[model samples]
Target: MPESTPFHDLAAFIALPRVSSLALSPDGTRLVTAVQELSSDRTRFIGALWEVDPSGERPARRLTRSGRGESAPGFLPDGTLLFLSSRPAADPGEGADDKQEAALWSLPAEGGEASQLLVRAGGIDGYATATAAARIALAAGLLPGAADAEQDERLREARRKAKVSAILHESVPVRYWDHDLGPAVPHVFGVPDAGAEPSVMVDCGARRIGGSGHIAVSPDGSLIAYTAALGTLPDEIRDAVVVVDAATGKQLRVLEAPDAEFGAAAFTPDSRHLVCVRERRITWDSPGDVTLWLADATDDQDPGRDLLPAFEQWPGAPVVSPVPGEDGTPVVWFTADEGGHAPVFRLSTGSGDIVRLTTSGAYSDVVASPDGATLYALRSAVDSPPAPVRLDAAASGQEPVTLPSPGQPAALPGSLTEVHTTAEDGTALRAWLVLPQDARPDTPAPLLLWVHGGPQTSWNAWHWRWSPWVAAAAGYAVLLPDPALSTGYGQHMHERGWAHWGGASYQDVLALTDAALRRDDLDGERTAMMGGSYGGYMANWIATHTDRFKAIVTHASLWNMYSFAQVTDFPAYWMRRQGDPLENTERYERESPHLRAANITTPMLVIHGDKDYRVPIGEGLALWNDLARFEVPAKFLYFPDEGHWITKPNNIRLWYATVLGFLAHHVLGEQWQRPDLV
Candidate 1:
């Protein structure tokens, strides 16, 4: 028999290098990517920038290293590689401490040691550079009432000296994701010269929440476009694109709509237009829709024109061609979820024509060559980890050539196939099945049914957090299904499960699971179900509604729909879909899994991260308590430091170990040996 792969061993899997984020130089001669690997202590993943040969010939080379690591690689106009890091500056000034914030650092094109380019008291959140100019625009936090960096630094110092960690909120949301939204709010700053101090370009004020707003710089270094929440009413909160004069830090125009949310701006190479994402806000009667729009970067009054009025799939961040097409019309490149894959697409701004450039795999961070002949992006799929790939800019349905990368995983211990079925209502369902190599007609592998989160997202891309290959290595067939509300299937898919999370969505999963079990390589008699977030919520629903699965694993899940609506970081978003619990309790009462917890008979493994503001800890705690109240066989795995997802290397190792152990005992009928240091 073939030996098991890295997915079979927790330590080995955790040590595997992961690559993400792609950056192409202005000249298109260099391709850089951020690679994360297990740190020396094996406690965390350290990120470092690596250079990938654009020609796909030379081996990738590491560009920088430090204990604190580096990320968000962007090339300057002069070929300097810029990144964000918290490492101590080479020349520390007064009050510099061992614990430093993430500052801007740059390495010369000729290659040498990196030097700090800019540092702030609150640290730089993210930054973007002008393509044709040396102008740099960054996002940083400014404490309330602070006019400049000096005052901001003084406020931070005073707060540190006083040991005050409090954040006063005057807005609706006080927290976002895993962190508090502030005593400090994000502001866009512009640095026109190499040594000049960054001037505040746009003060986001109390309207902004979470980390930092998305910022984009015009190619000519003349304009800056960013995302910010507008309007004063809490219920009417909508994000709008704010375009500003990069030189004067003056507001030029705000692109917004009464019922739409816009952000993720990409300026055309000519710096005359902007390509951005626009999502219509969800309402009680209808679901939201996402599409691309073209706007005049300088002055367009109305909410621009829809570039994808007829396109079904929602496009991701746009990457305008550095040079116009052969016909002299500007072209935009982007990736959009289509069927079971995310394909790169080419869009013409002049004719409103869109064409698929890639046939398979999910693509991200796509950048066009300076000559507009090639495209570079990071591509991954259900059976593959992310890797750098080069693609033809204008080709249709062409396969991308994988470039030399350090993130290649070992050969899988199994093979991948597809499963398809039709829901009760005639809606077609699809899934990816990872089948162990040893499984045969007489000796079928026990199945593990894995549901995807987002309820609005598809199971098309590679996900390190919930990779099915790991389970496949353990002699199981993992089924990943795209149920109702899954993207890429057009507007009707979302409408199917709108506010009916447990109805059609649940049935779609069951239909796909049933179809997968029909395969000779899968064992229907011994199966388990698992999910996180919305997937977790589905797991809970399945547990209460049926006992088909031998075991179930739910993480960062929702237990009580009414309570979840109130506690989630973005209450309005959920309320918009679920409605006010007090005013309309029918849906909340009918869908809440906690209310039906007594029906659970299958053994369960409950996982939750305390810092997850999206679902919050109460859901997990309540689910655990309900399980205990009903004397259900279950185990609760909690991570205090993790939020939404388990990020720490050690925590992830433990997470996988415990989960696999639980599955082994329940599905395979093996005695469970507790993972070490549990």
Candidate 2:
């Protein structure tokens, strides 16, 4: 294979098609994936569906095409493909509007033009189809006091004519990540078959916050399980699994625990049992653990059985095997972060045995064959983009067979290697080191320490947002480290930095950087640090603690702990770790990066998005204000239309251009040059 050019050419890099998700047909002979490409104007991404051959004999082909694009592909029992699309309908009288929300569409297995299947007044947010009963369940938003679709339309028109945008909320959480949850409450509706009007199954009243479409129908189509908050208080907002009758939409059972939360319900192949994830709630000192539980689908009063009592690694959503075991018992499969990789693992319901399947790389979108002989998933690693792969369901520590992928990304421009170091407290620390192809000991590349977000997330997979190859293309060695609080490292590793976010985790990062800088191929003297979100928080912390780096870049960073804990989208989640500022000022004062802003001497570039609710734009404003007040050399990069991430293609290009320019000026002693548009 020819070596791909480094991502220095922003246009070329942004134009490359990116694959997001995968879905397999019932028989597993056909696979579909969602690929996103830059829009014609090169400002945003448009998604479309593509089909990959499971036999690997034929090249993947495009399955659906529309200007508005299609996504969330799933297969009905009859081999028809069901997906959501916002494209205008072919019929003028169908009331299709280009700006309307996505509606469900179906393409027959016999190969014909697709047609709109279900159109809701509020538009369908998501839907799930049952294999045995052929029933469909949809999640749609309902206007208050509107009982049916006609009433919903009437209320919407009235509001539009009155020019009213007010949302009366009596709940604790009025807003989610990026949107307001208000006058239109989310409800799950049942559709007996295609083209049938949906009947409300679960009405999440005005105050009840329901899942946005996180629902699963039983194999027999007898029950629909969804997530809903048990209480209205901030601390009591943990989600619980609710099972209801599929036909009547009547509540059958409520699964909840005082110390743990449950979600992601999957029914067994026999439809006799439902398996769900149980996540222990997080506290100020203890990091939570996740395991699986089995509940009887028929009995509402019976408590579920704990499958993995002492599982160390936090498991992802549980997926029941389509095929039963040889002894007539069911099996569950899931992926979990282990060391530096996320691998698939299978659990035997009969013996309670857990076995690791794939050895390396992160796997997702797992789909089991009808006979349960094979599993299909999208696999990715630090050096590889996501690609379809087939795995033997019953095997352990086996390599997966690569299937033909549509628009596979170009080969990486640089080489990847793993680096390891022990933290001060004896915890293992690891990172993926991306080195330039031309790097040599005589001409060492400048080092760029890239901290990952989710301070709790590990750098176990490929990421397009903060890809290290771009820096490597610019002749820099990038250090992608997973320090304390990073997942896949077991509960103890998370506990090391549980409440003290900046203490051990910060030291672990420095320790790993020290280990990497010891390499002769990496130049320690010409080093810089950059991170976003939690990583950005660490960058701010680093700027205050040490003057070792010449420059630092922080994006969507949390600077003031006191203010951030209160203003973030999830105040309760942050307060769980730092405690309330009114009562617990010690943690805020000891760990906050803004309090020590005056001690920083490194030149900093602060980046933020005005629409970001996770970190909030106020963090950037406060950091910029403090930098100016302290007479620090700093620059602020602002994105008005972006959210937590700079997702727009043009905006992202500018981000990289400005970042590279900043590093060149500060770390390499080059003349400062402003980026093109900014």
Highest TM-score scorer: 1
Provide TM-scores for the models.
0.98, 0.97
Model 1, 1-678: lDDT tens digits are 857788878788888899999889888999999999988889989999999999989999999889999999998899999999999987787767575699998999999899989888889888999988988888888899898888888899999999999887777777788876788887787778555654434343223752236788898898888888886666677888888888877888888888998888889878888888888899877788988888888785655798888898878878888888667767888888878899998998778888898888999888888888999999999889999999988889799899998997577889988999998888888888888889899889999999999878899998889988788888889999999989888888889898688998999999999899888877899999999999999999999999999999999999999889998998887888788887988789889998998899999999999999999999999999999999988999999999999999889888988999999999999998998888
Model 2 scores a TM of 0.97
Candidate 2 lowest-lDDT run of ten: 204-213
Q: RMSD per prediction, one decimal? A: 1.6, 1.9
Off by over 4 Å in 2: 1-6, 199-213
